[model samples]
Target: MRVKMRSKHRKAVKFYSTCFGFREPYKVLIDGTFVHHLITQRLLPADEALRDLLSASRVLGS
Candidate 1:
């Protein structure tokens, strides 16, 4: 299940990058709720997690 989800996400990223003009160092909008969840889930230092999830070299947060 996890692998499938990862594959799907990768495909989506590829599609967007190819069809559109999306590039690396993807920009992400972080909200309060997301921050709360991260803290509760012990996933602090959000940048690392987002980078891994997005398969990006870097992550620019807003």
Candidate 2:
């Protein structure tokens, strides 16, 4: 699934990915911290980190 981020939460995404042992570099810096892809085609769970991110970046009527 493709996820569109509302805001580029760079540090948070990187930190979370790192914590989860995501793909190498674990930190892709683009669009001011908007992670285009995560975990090399792996499915990300609906965890708190993602929830917080979504809540923070949630767009209206989305």
For each candidate, what is the lDDT?
Answer: 0.81, 0.43
lDDT by residue for model 2 over 1-62, one digit each (tens)? 12445345555567666797754322323342334343443424423345555443432221
Span of 10 residues, lowest total lDDT, candidate 2: 24-33
lDDT of 1 by residue, 1-62 (tens): 27887788888899999999899878778789989988998876889877766777888766
- Cα deviation in Å at residue 14, candidate 1? 1.3
For model 2, the stretches where C-alpha displacement exceeds 4 angstroms are: 1-8, 24-62
Q: How accurate is candidate 1 locally (lDDT)?
A: 0.81
Best by TM-score: 1
Off by over 4 Å in 1: none
| lDDT accuracy of residue 1 in candidate 1 | 24
